[model samples]
Target: MAEDLAREEPRFPPAEADVLVPLVPARREGGAHRVRFGLAYLALAAVAGAALGTTVVVLDRPGKTAGPEWSSWQPSGDRDAHPRQIADHVSQRYRRPSGTQLVAVTYAGEPQVQQVPLSAVAIQTGGDGSDSPPKFVQIENGLMYNLCGLGPSCAFPEGELSEGGLQLLRREALELALYSFKYAGADSVIALLPPNVGNQQDPDDDTSRTLFFQKRDLARELERPLRTTLLAPEQPQPAEIDPDEGLIIDRLTQPRLFQYEIRQAQEGSAFLILAPLVGG
Candidate 1:
């Protein structure tokens, strides 16, 4: 029976084989058992490779990086952060102390950026009873005057301006003088005479004295303009004195002195590339 089986199975000759193997078991299941696990593993590997390829394709799509615009662009620094930048521009034009205070302006709500150029800012002085001349001054219209105290002795009659009166006026005038100007030119100075008092000099003629603010000959030596105001015990004769703003030429014979303060908003400065203001 073994020889018959061997003959039917076609066994290899012993001289030709180190170990005789049978093909019967392999052929019994049509080779399915031999390759079943390998085929399953190959299918799994193909599925995994397809998933990885899909992920790579999705990541390589266009229009993927659209970040915020501001992420790359930064805002400027605070407008007031660099006061010296403005001061340096002013210093080039005017003789000034290093201690000059700079008033910076910016967008109302924003503190980190300048709304205007450094030259556009103006400086105002404080009337602290001191004779230090104001740093920033303006010549708008024709007159150059500051506000007066609302007291009874606000006006000074012409006759009462004696040597003592002149002394007092001079003290006040020092405060109002514009020593260091940023926006005005030396030639822009003008004189404004006090208003004539009702054209009468009668007894009890309680009228405000005529005061004048004269421009100095800055070409010779820079002189501060005269600053005058009246201090009386009663209401002003006109009831209210409007601020005079225009150029007026008159004598400052009995010049009076007054103190004044300069504020930033009240003044303006500019780094003008000044050509002729108008065309030919």
Candidate 2:
């Protein structure tokens, strides 16, 4: 009976059918998933690259620049040797851009200049101690007044008049005073020889004590004082004069020594006052 049933059914064991699993469909699904993951990773990489590129572009631009530079220039030739020529040069160049100029002067190695408008005046004065009191004066932006005085005659041990006294006075004056120029008008300036008096000594005594006066400080004392009533106002009531004119200017033009007088005897004392030269 078993043989007959086996022949009629042509049957295999159920275990063989179970053994034929759907391997191809599972492999296809796994491959599809892997492809999707790869594409996602590529998209993420592209996004990161784009973000980095944007960051790099924003960090490149421009900023601030520099300022104006002044070239080293000497005055019209050596006209600096003469105060009057310097004044004229300053007058001619006395404007900026449309109408201002810068005038500079140097003593030893220190240099000073001013920015003045047209019509301002620049002045420079020089003399022996005999013409003006030896003094040092400086103004912020206006006129400077100066005085020079000559040395007194002196007798040497030989009972003869010695030129050494004059020479000493000249040296003292040269060391004591300075020529200063300041703006006097919109287009002009005035030169000044400031007094540098060290003291009032007897003409006969070579060893007398000298009293010194700093012209610049004295001018300031006249304008503004410290602690004491040493300064006296100008007399003759110059008629409620606008102090500004005497104390102000567009700017201060430094003094230049055009010519120097070694020993003229008329002891001179020049006083300088600076005032604004603009605004009515």
- Give the alpha carbon lDDT tens digit for every residue of 108-188 in model 1: 221111332222112223433545543433333222322222223433344433333232222222222222121222122
Q: Quote each prediction's TM-score.
A: 0.21, 0.24
As a whole number from 0 to 100, the lDDT of residue 250 in candidate 2 is 10
Candidate 2 per-residue C-alpha lDDT over 1-280 given as tens digits, one digit per residue, 9 for 90 to 100: 3342222222333544446655566777778988997997787777767765655555443456643322122234342343433344323432222232211222221111232211221222233333443433332233211222222221122222223222222222222222222111111122322222211233333331111223443344233322122111221112222344223211111122222222212333222222211111
Please list the residue runs of candidate 1 whose C-alpha ends up more than 4 Å from where it truly belongs after superposition. 1-143, 147-150, 156-163, 178-203, 214-218, 223-280
- Candidate 2 TM-score, C-alpha based: 0.24
Candidate number with greatest TM-score:
2
Clashes of each: 30, 71
- For model 1 the TM-score comes to 0.21
lDDT (Cα) of model 1: 0.28
Candidate lDDT values, in order: 0.28, 0.29
lDDT of 2 at 122: 20
